[model samples]
Target: MTHAPTPAAMATRKPARTAPAWDRHTWEEALLAATLPHHGARLLGWGLAHLAPTSGQFRAGTSRDAGYLGQALRLSAKQLHMGFSQLERAGLLARAGAAATDGPRHVLAQAFTLTLPSATAAARTESDG
Candidate 1:
């Protein structure tokens, strides 16, 4: 005998929530774009570099706590968060751990590493001045 379809199984899955819906962009996309314009990738690299030192010699699975302008990148708070999201996407960075904050726990505490780029290193020196 054929079994009848259950209401629970009949329910359709809902699409994930995106930004305000002014554009077809996801929140991650918007974060990356808004934060890093000409130097989206560049900013991300710098942030990664700084994370290592701040974490006190790189502990595996320990999330690096970096704000918007990690190291010498020179980015705004919003930009910093956006660049981080971008780095995570490009596979240049990854989440290692988590931490608690007074307000709320941001993903910053996770241990992360920066995949150095040739151009990025060069830009770092130039922007350092």
Candidate 2:
């Protein structure tokens, strides 16, 4: 006989996430909407989508350490570390200031800004001017 589900199990279960449907957008818009080629690009995209502020040049958030984020992203901490580095190298992600120091092991979250590729190019051009 099957037993009823336990409270612990019920509490640990997560609902399936639904993918967003696109409207009447252009092919280029759809292409740009896909995750970038960089390793951590998807993570940055996730931040931009979930953290609000999709318009404009930059999206900012305080990201928790890799282990915690990995759990939510279905990635390993090592993978998260690599992704973070890749995004930083591609100029897509960066520390907003310093790491937050108000949580466990003095490691809670990292303040970061995710920059759009067009904005990055514009910044480079302006600096060269």
TM per model? 0.38, 0.41
The lDDT per prediction is 0.45, 0.47
lDDT of 1 by residue, 3-92 (tens): 977877768656688633222123224334332333755455544454445322345434444443344465555555665555545444
Would you give me the overall lDDT of model 1? 0.45
Candidate 1 lowest-lDDT run of ten: 21-30
Q: In model 1, state the lDDT of residue 45.
A: 55
Worst 10 residues of 2 by lDDT: 22-31
Q: Which candidate has the top score in TM-score?
A: 2
Distance from true location, Cα of 106 in model 1, Å: 3.2
What's the TM for model 1? Answer: 0.38
Cα lDDT over the full model 2: 0.47
